[model samples]
Target: MDEQLNHAPCGFLTLSEDGFILEMNQTLLKILNYSHDSLIGQHVNSILTVPARLFSQFYFFPLVKLEQRVEEMYISLEAGNGEEIPVLINALLRKVNERTVLECIIIPMRKRNEFENELLLAKKETEAALKAKHKAITELETTLKKLEIQKQELLELNQQNQKYKIETQKELELARIIQETSLTDPINNDKVQMEVFYNASGELSGDIYGIYQIDQNRYGIILLDVMGHGISSALITMTLHSLFQRLISAGVPVDLVMKELDSHLHKLFDNNEEARHYSTAIYLLIDTERQKIDYANAGHPPALWQDPNGTQYELSSTAPPLGTFEGVVFKTNTFTYKKGGRLLLYTDGVDPLISNYLAPLVRKTVSLPLFQLKQEILQCLNNEKKVDFKSDDETFILVDLK
Candidate 1:
């Protein structure tokens, strides 16, 4: 038993009741960094680095003397290098061969302390990385929310623009209808054998005309050509129509009415910014009771007359167009209608085929009634073999004695 205690793997020592080291094995000697002879006579309290008073007075002497054994108590010892080493100590009081002895075993605690410290450090590192990743994810989510808000705003703006476009188109169509309703027809009287054909290059036109009864035995006719073809020209024609209706309703004379109309038009559009902005017209007043006609031309085509015997005559121009000059006088030329004859007034659009095919026919067939002349014009138009023959607005008014 003594040899086995001396050759133990762990440290073993024996102490007296006075806390002195009575005997120590070779293992205890090497572990405590002391010689056996040096440790045997030393006090155990002197080799321990921990506070020795508590262990000696309260734990080691009382517990071991009364209970005979103390299990797994913690203590500290000093190494040869003066470094402190933590240890688990077990002590017992035993009797062997009629002699009392105190024995102790010391177990070092360094490996467990190192493992707990490494675990704490790894946990701290993982927590810090997780916090950083969470912050990045929060930033990305915020950016996505802002971009979604901007997209919604753009979609709303596009819808508003489309609504405005639809409203503007509706307003434009309304204006076109109003302009069309205001146009006056020259062929409504039974005494006038007239035909008018009008086609615009676009949705709106610049051509306009009207026939009015001046008195119980007199009639007035007008054909006007404004500058352009769309909304601007349409508005001008509307204004002219209103002005003429008002004058005729007030029973104004044809000559004075023409003069006043020119003055008003010149004043209204003299400073107009558009370069090609003016109106050209022809006005004629016929006294059917007296068998005579009085006419004025302002840069318009000549009027044609066909007698009952099939003789043709052309009435020429006398003045410049309306809105061209202020205070300009319009002269009236008088001619005998010669009972049973017809007078014809027309716009430039009427003879589209005159230069193409009807010129030779007109020069050859000068002896024809006004209706036959119109038929000739239509015949020349229909003879064209082309599929697309676009023509301008054609208007013609023929007057005969009742």
Candidate 2:
């Protein structure tokens, strides 16, 4: 047992309770590069490095005192040449011949340190690579999520825009149909031959005209223009149509009809400080047997009459527009409704937008059918890529007395 302990693979030593070296084997003498005679009586701390001495005093010594053993503690010892030799130590408490001592084994750690350092470096590199890959993957996922949200928002906006366009188109078509129906078949009788032409600035117009028959001998011709365009003005035109039929059917004279119209409209629209609505109108009662026409014009354009001898007669206004005042009086004018004479009635937009360019058209086709005149005017107004109208409604009426 003594020989085996002397020549052990690792260093073996015995320490006094206060750390003086009591006995040391040849293995420990060889590892520390010391002669047995030189160190056998020395303290164990004599060969410890500064850090190892502090660690032994603080950590392993306290543990050995309490549990009486310390296992596998790494430290460095000083060699005879004053070099630090890394080692691992394990110690156990013992009592020999009534003397307290510590038995310790020392292991050289050069080969073990190299293997553990390589392992530690490999672990650090792997962790760094994993962190970088994780960051890159997270950023890519965030970008993809944002792109998907943007695409969805654009799709929804496009869908909503398409729906609005369809709804607006439907409304325009409905307004056009109602307007055309209201002006249909105003004249078709033996006593009068009439040609009517009407055009709107856009989807709706403020212009309205029609002929009402009072009896076989007497008939009323009417034209009205509201102040503005679109649905609001178109509504006022229909309201005026209703008022005309009611007042005229009640046997009201042309002047009294104007007075009643002004009073009613002013009461409804002009009661406030500012008047809201008004219109210009021409209403005429023609007697075929007497060949006389009695007319009341409310702030309208003058009627033009061209005789067979090429002379022009102007039938101008007789009163201010309706809805302007409550108690305004209206006058009546009369003219002879001669045979073979031509009467032209129009809104203000006609001469500015159409008649100037279409004068030669009418002059050349003067002897043609009256319906052709209405057709020629429509052809010019319906030409695409053209902007004849600025903002107003246009109406042209040509009445040839048969």
Which predicted model would earn the best TM-score?
Answer: 2
Give the alpha carbon lDDT tens digit for every residue of 1-402 in model 1.
Answer: 389888788778787766788887887677777776776787786577533333344345766887888666656787666567776678888876677878888766555445445445545544554567655765655555544555465566457447645754664465566555665565434455454445454656777777777667777777777766765666567667778777765666667767877876776554434433577787777777887877778877777666666666766667888888767888878888676666666666655332444444554555565467677766655665254476555555656654
**Per-prediction backbone clash count:** 0, 0
Quote model 1's TM-score.
0.52
Q: Give the CA lDDT, 0 to 100, for residue 218 in model 1.
A: 75
Tell me the alpha-carbon RMSD of every candidate: 47.6, 42.5
237-261 per-residue lDDT for model 2 (tens digits): 7666677777776657898877876
TM-score of candidate 2 versus the correct structure, residues matched by position: 0.55
lDDT of 2 at 334: 87
> Which residue runs does candidate 1 get wrong by more than 4 Å?
1-173, 186-191, 249-251, 352-391
